[model samples]
Target chain A: MHPAPSVIIFTALSGLGFGLMAWLGFGLPAVSGWSAFTFFFVAYALAVGGLVASTFHLGNPKRAIKAFSQWRSSWLSREGVLAIVSLLVIAVYAIGVIFLNQRWQIAGWAGALLSLGTVFTTSMIYAQMKTVPRWNTPLTPVLFFLYALAGGALLAGQTGAAIMLLIVLCSVQVLAWVLGENSFARAGHTIETATGLGNLGRVRLLESPHSGPNYLLKEMVYIVGRKHAHKLRVIAIFLMGLVPVAILTLLPTNHYMAAIAVLSHMAGLFVSRWLFFAQAEHVVGLYYDKR
Target chain B: MTSLPQSTQKKLGLAIDLDTCVGCHACVISCKEWNTSNYGSPLSDMDAYGAEPSGTFLNRIHTYEAKTLERAAQVVHFPKSCLHCEDAPCVTVCPTGASYKRSEDGIVLVNEDDCMGCGLCAWACPYGAREMDVAEGVMKKCTLCVDRIYNENIPEEDRVPSCVRTCPAGARHFGDFADPDSNVSILSAERGGFALMAEQGTNPVNRYLPPRPKADISGSGQIGVPATALGEETGGAKGFLSWLDKALEKI
Candidate 1:
């Protein structure tokens, strides 16, 4: 909930990178030589850069390699594994397309599916968090997938795909916002439920356990200013969805407009992602009446 | 393995009696004193003596006012730590397999050596029980005093967790909940000990005893009439002179 800049960067950049790779795997831009090499280079740099950025937030980044071992149960591990697998597959596909001048349809399809799957796994890393009710919903994955696909389409200069995805993702983003707002407003747990004291008519926080902030308080009790959050959400929606759609529709296929759309959507999504973490209300926070 | 066992051999946990707890915070201090030195990290403090002190700890006592009626209110001090759940999200959500629940004793523990302290397990915990030690760069939590509970170096009688040992009101309990005959199991059955945040489906092993009915605080201790009133002889006295005389004589 602290909205660590590294995590924000990782999610935004990687989603776009993977999105582009998925499209590129399909041979969408249909190019070769230096042109194809540049595309592949940009995709790999973003995807890998985002992955590496994630480790910077870890308490011990040197041991991050160990995270790959727990894929059986952990979504976070699944995400790590999937990201690596996708990256590797994308690498092979990139080589085939650039060097061999071969689409290798099956490998392309495989890479595309895996790239999408990696993004899905990454979404689940947050979506599976039952503690944060705002994140523990199907809409979270939907919102993420839409962002990836839409962001990717825009980067590849696929005007039709970008416009279509932008339309759908904008609607989904609205729904996500609505659901997120209602998550805490209509949460099942309260101070009484949190404390296992439902029999008590009404429970209220009288005194906090500690005089100073502790780990839980710092990490879990993140409270964003309501008015500020509202203003930011409006800004995010306008920048990420509305403006991009407007730009793509108005300009149709202008190179500069496409670039503008990509950058605007990225900035917008970053702000929204920040709010996603900042606004998340962990059920445990109910005990502290944070919700 | 990160995957959970089908069933654990034991479910060791604590049952705190909210009824008798006087909120002395003895358990809090004792836990810190024992765990800071014995556990993985020293529970480092940042600006401990400054204007804003902060630190890491596994257990915390939350105080609340339960108002049954406008005039009837009870103060509740809740002591919370990891429940070591049967379906612990913390254990399953761990990326590095550092967080695990033991199949033998059911004590949730952090293998600090393997932990990268990504804090994802902490994010998954609905109880807010997991703590990240800033100094060690690893997650820490209530091991149920695993190091002391089974340590042969310690006296047999002192084998319980520190919080249970130092609870001044004897409100904190530690035992094998898997045993139907254990004190915690019996207490849970008798007093209707309930799990915290049951809807979360963690199936918490730890429980809290509901607040028992309190005796009426009104009427019972009030005196109807004073048997030896000093003012009896000065009832007809005028002004403050006689009233002061009667009060002084009584004193």
Candidate 2:
């Protein structure tokens, strides 16, 4: 919930990159070898580069290779495994299409699906967190995938699909914020329940767990005021959806407009991604009376 | 082997008595002292003797003032640590095979050797129990004093967790809950002990005994008619107020 810079960069960049990769596999923006090569390079840079950025947050980045061993139960492990396998599959598909000028239908389709799976795994890393009730909903994955698809379509030069997805994702993002605001309405406990003083009466935290920042408070108790969140949401929607859609719709063929649209969209997405982490309320924060 | 053991031999855990704990933080200090030199690496301090000092600690005593409609406010010293849950999300979420729950005693532990210190397990755990030791680049948590509990070098009486052994008020209990007649099990049964955040579905082995309710003391000489205030109303309203005044001598 800290809105860690490295993780935010990773999720945003990789979502774009994998989105591009999936669209490339789906045979959008048919281009010659050199153009395809450029797209692949950008896609890999965003996907793999975003991945490398993720290591910066690790306490011991050197031992990350061991993370792949526990895929049976851990979503993080599955994400790592899926990323590697998807990159490999995408690599083969890229070579087949760019070098040999052959579609390799099986490789193309498989690569596309796996790239989506890789992004899904990434989203699942947060979506599965029961500690953050706002993110522990079926809507988390849906929003993540929609964002990826919207950004991917725009990056792929598929304005038609990009416009459609941007509209949907923006709507969902607003919905998510609304739902998230009331996420804890049906929480299993109150402060009274947490302290086992329910029968006694209402309970309030008169003393904090600690005065200074502890690991739990620092990491899990992130809070964003409702007014600031609303303003940011408006900015995100205007830039991510309205402006880009307007640009794509009004100047359907202007390369400058398209470039401006993509830049605005990505920037807006970065802000929302930050809010996603900032607004997440971890249940442990309840223990500190911070939630 | 992140998969949990199908049949754990013992459910070794702590049973905290909320009624008796004094919030002295002795258990916290004792845990830090014993664990800093034991099975794991030193629990590193960011600024040990500086203006802003902080460190990784497995056990922490959270003191809360509970104000209830039924009684006056009561201060509850809740010492929290790893509960070693039956369905521990911490162990399952560890990407590396570092976090695991032992089949022998059902105590969840982090194998510092393999831990990459990604901090995902800390996120997975609902209780805020685990702490990532940035200095050692590994997650640290309550091992239930795994090293001391099984060590023959220590005296048999001191083989329990350092927190349990150091609690002066006898509030911390250490025992195997698998045995129906274990001290912890009996204490839970008799005191109506309940698990913290049972709805989280972790099935934590540890229990907290809620403080027994007393006469409603929302106002008055604390309790309206304390035994000490008895036979005072017979004198009249003025005399009763005087008797209540006598009870407020400590104020």
Which candidate number has the best TM-score? 2
A159-264: candidate 2 lDDT, tens digit per residue: 8899999999999999998988877656565666566766656666666655556777777887755349878888989988999999988875777888899899
Q: Identify the runs in model 1 with alpha carbons over 4 angstroms from their true place.
A: A185-187, B217-251
In terms of lDDT, the poorest run of 10 residues in model 2 chain B is: B228-237
Worst 10 residues of 1 chain B by lDDT: B218-227
Instruction: Mark the 10 consecutive residues where model 2 chain A has the least summed lDDT.
Output: A203-212
lDDT of 1 by residue, B1-251 (tens): 57777789999999999998888888888888899999787888889899999887777888988865423677888888888999998999888989888889888888888999899998999898988888778998988999889989999978999999999899999998999999999999999999888888889999899999776552323334353542344555777977788888899
In angstroms, the error of model 2 at B242 is: 17
Candidate 2: pairs in clash: none
The digit string of per-residue lDDT tens for model 1 on A3-87 reads 7778888888888889888998888888677788988898888899999999998998889999999999998898899899888
DockQ of each: 0.67, 0.60
Tens-digit lDDT string for candidate 2 (B1-251): 78777869999999999999888889889999999998889988887677766789898877777665546667778889999999998998889889999999899988888988889999998888999886887899999999889989989999999999999999999999999899999999999999877777888999998887666544444554566655443344467677777677657
